[model samples]
Target: MQGNQLRTFMATEQLSTFNPVTLQLPCGMLRGQRLGDVQRFLGVPFAEPPIGDFRFKAPQALADWTGIREANSFARAAIQSPRPPTLVPDDPGYSEDCLYLNVWAPIAPGPHPVYVWIHGGANMAGTTAQPVFDGTSFARRGVVFVSIAYRLGILGFVDVSGLLGEAYRGSGNNGLRDQIAALEWVKHNIAAVGGDPDRVTLGGESAGGKNVISLLTAPGAQGLFHRAICQSGGGQTYADQLMAEDLAQRVRIHLGGESARADALLEATPEQLLAAQASLVDSYPAKSPFRAVVDGVVLEQAPLASIANGAGRDIPLLLGWNKDEAGFYGASANGDGGVVQQELANMSLSEFDQILIRYPEMFPHLKAEALRFKALTAESYGVPTLRIAEARARIGRPAYVYRFDLPPEQGAFRGLCVHTSELPLVFGNVQLPTAEAIGPVEPAAQRMSGIMHSLWIDFITAQPILSDATTIWPVYELGARQVAILDEELRIKSDPDAGERMAWTTWQPVAAE
Candidate 1:
């Protein structure tokens, strides 16, 4: 055990294989490797592979196995292209059998807090293997981190029951059901990986955040998580009531198949279905109709309605939106010049005039751009938070609200903290390179990362995020609403955008021409 001899032994041993062990899941015993003092399990099947006969159907329980399965490499992600055009790599893979989970945990015996991450891709795209999503940082900090893969696109959220029957009644929420199954797996198996099932925190950004809200209202997901962090994607209002069914029928016709039923569509290949779904996106200029349906069972009712009636009353929540969420939407709408122009054109004369009435001087030069930004800010983030915050306040539950305003350093999008900007920061992986559309992360970004991650850990452990280093985050109140503005320096602001808030408060859908 001399110093030189010990050094030689350490050099020879692979750090990732020091304390390997087997995890006994309902499906099988999986061999998990070790990294430093933590045990890492990747690509563990939480549910049956959703391929062939199971595609588009609700996730099924993983079948039992006798041998130890290798849990090391990440499984194939659900069929999806990357986001924002620039982020999509040259050769990204896709598949139907993509229901899997990755875990990072301390190699100790006692149970520890667990953080389950749901990724953001607007409910259409995104995967669990994004470099920024690596959970090792959180695991290194003594929290078990889990990243999960759920169904996406047509396979994930098409409502065909209107044309089908009770067999396909809840098909619209298949993606959501996949998430619940992952949580159920965590509840039953996290202990084997040294995680406390009781202290699970469900969190995500954008579409992932939307999923967190869906879980909050979904009855099947009750008691599966104790704390929730929804960033940037709060306050999702379903685009239209018939959108889900309409999208499904479109898919059926595009496939050139006679059967327009949900069960019949399940027999199609994943690629064929995804192509059909993508075609719909190309055809529709306003918005994609594929999203979680308000089924009387899985979703029960609109999340806003549930929150209004105290659905997730006991669960503590940390929710917020970014300052420039619409910037990203504008970038995504690049190919559709007509859509972008129409949106910009409508911003001034549309309902957003109420917003212009308040911030008439904010961006005097680019009137249309400013108007589009304000309108989107109201609908996407502002109104949703107002609705949910009022619901949470009414139910007497502790909730903290925040607004992220850390602007990017380069490009026309400079000074705007667009959607998904907080992803790299929250995960403490801001060092990763950003694509063209997403500028490089600044050196000062890590400070905000530390703050956000620490607050999240504190919330999961203490129910209310407590910190002495930053501003005291107060529980949101309906009337005297207080919000913590996250930036270079945290500031406590009251009614930061009163004009935009009032606009969303009185928002109503306009009739289609």
Candidate 2:
């Protein structure tokens, strides 16, 4: 169905429903709320809560329930140290029992394409309860939108198999396992809520983006979704088994001593775990330690290598990065160049020299230190994204690449399209208060939001997209390498930054090692 026809049908359907919506699924009956053109089911449990005995273990499917469950409110966010700007309003607060997901669907009939979102907070601190993630826009555009929550920090990514033995062999990736289980639930039950089981699109930003890309190589994630959209996160980095174990050891040290047993770490309270996690993060101030572990069981190899060898080769992808992703971290006056320096420190002598030479004048307007920071963004976000697109293109798959260059004219991220700057525009929540921090939501910005939002809706619907009679989004093939540049004006450029791409060949992520 086309966008206009779907909206018209939904408008007609809206005239018939003044009552709450309900669905009788295999598990039980759920009573949801009807919000104008959309029907929303909130705080629906998809898996058994990962708490107490289930802590640090793979998620178990929720058992069938009795009676009609009220699905009107959002569940508690995953346990973590709450960060500003990203926190949910009138916050549902935090908890270990946070495996619930929220859904939004069009009121009109039939199954619509599904869009499942995994939120981004370095895999240690985000929740789907944020207002920016509200699915009203997508539902109005005739799509079923879902946002899921999972365990975070030590509870989510710290590998304890080395200490706890075989039962927790893949425990480090419990967060990812939670995401897979959510997809499984959607695949089996989304049909009841006007979602097409075969046409699901998984998308996310930052840590969430990294998770979706990792899912491309995850054995448990195959056939769960058909398309992917990764925003401002790349597949170049991941925690290998050794790195995962190091995090486990650090947690133990913080809890007791080096001689601490598995029980000492596992039996610790949520407060104790958060304390240890804080210390762990402080120790490694450069980057987030929480990431999917390449354990032999869950993931046999690094994601990029697996993708190169044709893992998820058939899935169409919409991949891109902002003009300055790392700028988000360095936005403050007392900016820590530690993150950029640490990434440079990971490189060899020759690789480090190459970066300094190539990036010192890359962005001529920025000062010396700022230029290096931009280079870090290119190395971390740009290079890996381009590499993944190239891999998919080589395998003859569709990879619609884009580059978001529209910086805010005013506010915290003024003149810099930092990480997550495209979210408000893509999600069509430009007027939200949090969005104002990124930039002013003036008429020009609103127009930009419409252009970016429409592109995403088109990709989810698997329809041909034409921005105008003259401009078309071309596939990122090996030869052409066309990229849609989204700014005040949309421009499709061929290999926009050739020089910067070449400078990144020497350095490689630890995952590659």
RMSD (Å) per prediction: 5.6, 4.9
Worst 10 residues of 2 by lDDT: 337-346
Task: Give the residue spans of candidate 2 off by over 4 A.
Answer: 1-19, 85-87, 331-354, 466-470, 510-513
lDDT (C-alpha, whole model) for all candidates: 0.73, 0.82
For model 2, the local distance difference test gives: 0.82
Residues 1-513, model 1: lDDT tens digits? 964355436534644355667787655799977867777888888898877666666899987878888987777788876443345332236778889999988766657899999987867888776666778778877899999989987778877677666666788888899999999999998887889999999998877887898898889999999989888655454533366667677778876555655455766666677677777677653443556677775876777777777888888888998887777766424342222322321122345555455454654555556556655666666667666776799878878888888877887678777877777777776654442245336656667777877777778677344663757888898777888888885788887877557655565433111
Model 1's TM-score against the true structure: 0.87
Clashes of 1: 0
What is model 2's C-alpha RMSD?
4.9
